[model samples]
Target: MLLKNPQILYALFLLIIPVIVHLFQLRKFKKEQFTNVKFLKKVQLQTRKSSKIKKWLTLLARLLGLACIIFAFAQPYLPETSQSLKKKETVIYLDNSFSMQQKGKNGELLKNAIQSLLTALPEDYHFSLLTNDEIYKNTTKQELAKELQQINYSSNSPNFKTTYIKAKKVFSKHKNTLKKFVAISDFQEQNLKDLEFDAQLENTLIQLQPEKNFNISIDSVFVKDKNIENTTVQVNLSSSTATDQLFTVSLFDHHKLLAKSSVNFDDNTKANTTFSIPTSQDIKGVLAINDNSLQYDNSLYFSLQQNEKINVASISDAKDNFLKKIFNQDEFNLITTQSNQINYNKLSHQNLIILNELKSIPQGLANILSKHLENGGSLSIIPAETINEASYNRLFNALNLSRYQKKQTEELKITNINFSNIVFENVFNKKVRNFDYPKVNSHYYLNTGANQILSYNNGQPFLKQIKQVFLFTAAINKENSNFKQSPLIVPTFYNIAKQSLQLPQLYYVNENNNTIEVKVKLDKDNVIKIKDSSKTFIPLQQHFANKVNLTLQNEPKSAGNYSVIANDKTINLLSFNYNRRESKLNYANLSSYKHIKTQDSITNFFSQEINDNQMNFFWKWFVIFALLFLVIEFLFLKFLK
Candidate 1:
């Protein structure tokens, strides 16, 4: 037994007052003649005995009442023995990873675990719930449970080390009180092991087990096309098991299965297979294999579109045999014409027009090409071996060049290339060794609304792009400099022509944020439709120049394949994948907490060490006892009278 207010125990000293009053009782003796001696002797003896017994009984009751009152004022209580006194907050960590989706014989494992905890939780106990998804502190039971039901398996999992460190900061803010942390999760091998908990937190870790099975998944897929007729896609599959296993691989184009094949893999080896896709049809679909690691990478989607052909009109004073050979490639339709005789109206029909080493651009030629590009056409301008400044500015001004300056040649190489741009995709597979280009005597620098695609060592623009037009300012002939014979000649010429001609039939939406802006490059003004699973076609607003920004509202709910289309052209098809490292279900071990003290290990189960305002009701009981003693005293006095 313990007293909540020990200071009140001093009231026990009041017992001495009762003892003194009883001892100092005064009796009045009346001086009366003792008559009738014989009769008086018998009566006097009986009265004395009765009076003594009554006085003693009354004193005893008074003492008993006083003692009860003093003891009641002290406010005593019994202590619990099963658990230690808890005077701090409790934080509970719950694992909500995908592995927690494992079902037991009855139902979901997490549901059963929470039900058990609800039954054992004390009525006055307060706690917070933490999860692998996120943490919620100082929340009520009902609120936490509601949040728990809303949690689903996520591809991205939380890092235990980072989470633990955050928890430590939360606990440190309330350092004066004791903290209890309990974590429940699956103990995967990859989960945190031997992690040192913050010394301040009294932590208990619980590891839950889930059934496991072997799985195989397609690691990657790549498409290689050397020509329009032959395109081969290679698929690579990775597995967990070492034993030989057979798996089926299937190829599909827009829900139509084109081919299927089976292959066996040796233990722990990556299996590779190739399938030839017919270029005759516009192929857009997925290649998939059966696996359970994750569904996003299980299937790969790819599309192939018809290559656009560009018409090239070359005007040169002399027969540019090298330029003719380069333009003779099957992709380009090359036409040779004299500078004065070239027809400007015919330039509108061609995707690109080349001015090869022309001393001067004809009077109406620059204006026609400018209007052609303003209406959505591409152009490449190569200066002549000897050019006047006035002719160069006339051409440069039409291309939106900000400033034109001349620089002497220096020993430099083109070392950096932008690979993300579509223009240079796979154009230069090998390095341009010992390639020296003519030292640009004069170069046009772009300001606003322009991006430098490639730069030389001295930061000079090797390849510059303004709006949709690409300009290559290098000299085309060897007379000005030996640059034409350099290794950079073929790549430089090939990239410039390829970028100016190729039309985008497919778009890849690679924005990190939700929305993307896309400009359509089409031959005519046509209505384009964008649709989703609902099959509702939204007519895209075609701003001038066939440019539109496709606004994707939010990320797709589930990570998988998604596509957006613009009329016959499939604008973009992208895969949404999340980091799987956070999906690991392994939990911290709980064995270290077996010896930690908790409320359940204390002697006084209901006694709170921190709260002192609890009502004892001891004084009320004492008052009742005192009233009962007074009643008995009154009854005895009446009987004696």
Candidate 2:
């Protein structure tokens, strides 16, 4: 209990005046002689006793009523909290990630949370709001409501630790102040493991859970098979809960339906379907599934652009027949030139440069190869049997590759093949352990600092690659080694040349650090842009002589096919989709934390805050009590006598 104006309580001394008046009896009574002596004596005794009783009762009622009036004037109140000499700060962290599109009891998780916030905040109260992509500070309810209504799903994932630090920065730097942080989200466990709450701050973490946990998502889409006439596209699917349910997958080109298939997700929680399309045409494809649990991962976007031939430059001692057979004319522009007839200007435009059986490297050629690597071109080295080691060593040093050492005539069998490298992706149906082992005779004993793709029986690297450089320790000439006839020769050389171009994939995950190579010539000060039907923006790009390296950093806010435009022409097409990390719907258990208070609803938490900070006055109750005491005094005067 506390008083607003305690100085009014000094009127309590005025109650002593009423007591003195009651005791003095200032009006003296003149007694009249009674008719009979006995009757007068009896009547006088009874009157005196009744008079004393009335005086005492009236004195108590008057003193109590006067005291109640003084107390009412003092205006006492009940304190909800202790006396605060500090300022108050409130901050709200709202999650707008794609997973918040899940449905709860009311509607979508994000929509329901927004409605609760609208009802909880008062008209004049101000607070800071932090979302995945936007921030609003010291904003009123009206302003924040407008921003919330315009909010859309975000591709940026959530991290509670970063959010806590951001909330602290939003608060003013006052030493003596009360700060409260209210976080409302689905509380996915993806980024909550290392979050530590401040003990000095009041923290309320609310988890808006969905009604069900079962969800089906389109895991990925890729080109399973591609020939001259047709391309087979494979779609992978996954489920959160294990159930033998059949789901429908639809393939669309823009709005026209192309194909449909049914997938059965058994207890294994995986399924896949394939669709074949013409390999020659440009396709803006969309793969969609009917899943009501989460809407973001239910569809995938992809693009199939027209094929472009790869430029292969072979600088060899002579025209090798095997090299001619591998790089066909239909898909590869094979340019073969002798060492003396080399075109220095044509080297910069080639995608893959092969230093084929060079007897000795010139300083000029070594400088060119070094520049090619710096511009993101791939190089392969095939050394001669008896070559000038010093010249080749200088080339090796320039390219950061291992140099050939003293030549050995001993034989070593190619035993190990690393299947985990990205160069071997989708190259084999299954890992085959039994194959005709390839052997090399009279090979050089070289040292390397790279990933060993094919190793010898003695665990020595026969073929190793570091970044864009591939090295072979043995000579493939028929007189020296029969490795040219081995089954591993085709994939080993062909894929290395194929991987040199670094072409764009069917689709990329948005908001990730994804870099795609676009093979096009860029004029000076000219730029390319990625765009869809609604929005267009330039990506972070680096230009080489004949290609551009574009790094995506949150430009496409949706999942769809986009065009790569240069000089107002659509040179290439690409697609991007939101990451599927949130599809499993795994949530954190915030109740285990001691410093955090968990709330189920935003309205309930704010209601408790309002109640805790409110002041309840007792002045009205005191006024009512004073009136009651006055009524009791009147009752005594009217009926007790």
Candidate 3:
């Protein structure tokens, strides 16, 4: 026991003043007859004995009253004897990751643990709760309870290192007070190994252990055959125990089961199965295993769309065999045009048009190509081997290519090739080879707003871009180099033409005069452009990172199509059809309670324990004692009278 206010001990000095008054106060009696001297002597002896006893009793009562008052003034409390006691400002860290949704006997193990912690809280004790989702600080009981109820398991788990750093900052604010941390979770070995705990935290980890049960989940699903119109969807399943179990795998199209198959898994074994689904129509479905596990991975959702057709047109001299061999396939519409008979307006409708070894674009062609792009078309330009600077600059400026100085002829070989989504998915399917071409005398090297896709041996860009248009200035004609004879000739020409012909999906604002709200997911360095009929790219009134809402400079005269392009890849036109799945949510029932116990080595200063028997009285007992002392004083006075 300890006194909260020890200064009250000075009240003992008041006892001396009471004692002095009692000693000084006296009364004188009149002289009596000699006959009564004997009786008076006997009475005097009795009176002296009574006086001594009463004096002592009065002093004892006063002392007792003073002691009681001092004890009351100095508030005292008992401490706990246990060593593993917690502090008053305890911080509880709860894991709310998706893994915590694993069912126990009663329900979610995390839910049960939280409920137990709430039930065990003492009225005088206060605590704060943090979770893997977010931390709440200095909150009231009602607020904490409401936040707890609002918490749901999330797929994204918080990084332990980040949480530890945040916890350190929060704990540092209360350095003067005792602090304790309690982490409640499954404590899976995988999750624990990556965690770095702060050395400053006085913490205890509680691992909840639920009953072990067998679980089988769909590990992965993918299309096996790329060319086959009817695709094979493969599913892989795994189980913990080696019991031969029969399970059903179902494929659903818009919640309707299109196909179902039953398979048996040998005890403690893995299985792989395939289901054939026709790729005729765009299909979205899932493969589900009939086992109790995490639901997110149980059913894998996928979407499949049809491939778009690519149209290409090539302009070359009648004797150009390289262009002839590359576009020989039926998929390409190879058009040859002489300098005199070339009609540039007809080339606008084609997805890709190539100007090979051209001295100059016809009078209205450059402006026409710009209008085609503004209307959502792609173009590729291959400058002639021998060309003047004025002619080269005319084509370069039209494609937004920066000005450059010409370099002497050198044997350039394709060395590095980039495999972007445009190249791998839309163009060549990872089949590209090196080819040598004679470096031109007056070819321009791009400086800005251009991405070098393929580089030569000397680190010069062999294939580069200027906005949506692609330019390949390397020698392909027989006069300059033997590139026409190489095996890479067909794939290189085919890929370049296909990429240039692609067009962006047209996006139209519902109301042209009003604010046009466009929702798109964009990464850094991506440019968004809005254009008018004159083919001028206009900057938006306000540019945002992700979502954009801006008023157009002018109202559109008619309801037609607007163009949108990103990183040179056109959005799939068919994907614009809006399709959303609406189904009733099926929530699993809560499981039973899981037992977890945690221990800490540090002592708990706020621990409540019953102290051993000690000499102590309640305030009521002291009041009764005071009343009894007053009664004794009254009886003594009456007797004296």
Give lDDT per model, in order.
0.59, 0.85, 0.56
Score residue 466 of candidate 3 by CA lDDT.
62
Residue ranges of candidate 1 with Cα displaced over 4 Å:
1-137, 158-213, 226-231, 252-257, 282-286, 292-402, 409-461, 464-473, 478-531, 534-544, 549-554, 560-641
- 1-641 per-residue lDDT for model 2 (tens digits): 77878999999998999898888887865788877989888888897888889888977987888888899899988767763224688899999988899999999999989888888887877789999888899999987778888888888875778878988999998868789899999988877878889998889999999999889999998889988899999999998877877899999997889999999867688889999999987889999999888898988999987757788898887347788888888778889988788898999888899877778787688889888888878888887777789899899888877778888788888888888765566678998688888787877877744588888888777888888888888778887778889887788878888887767788988877888888888897899999999999998999887888988877677878899999889999899999898887889988777688888899989888777767778888888888888898898888876
Give stretches of model 2 more than 4 Å off: 1-77, 82-88, 124-126, 161-179, 191-201, 242-246, 266-268, 318-330, 340-345, 362-364, 367-371, 393-467, 478-491, 591-594, 618-641
Cα lDDT tens digits, model 1, 335-436, are 778898887667766656767767777867768778767755566666654557687678768766644456344544444555545555666776443444
Candidate 2 lDDT (Cα, 0 to 1): 0.85
Quick one: best TM-score, which candidate?
2
Error of 1 at 562 (Å): 3.8
Task: Give the clash total for candidate 1.
Answer: 17
Q: Candidate 2: deviation at residue 606, Å?
A: 1.3
TM-score of 2: 0.78
What is candidate 3's lDDT per residue for 174-276, written digit by digit as tens? 5556666667766544444345555455556656555554456656556666444687877766665566768888887546788888766774457778888
Cα displacement (Å) at residue 24, model 3: 7.6
TM-score for every candidate vs. truth?
A: 0.60, 0.78, 0.64
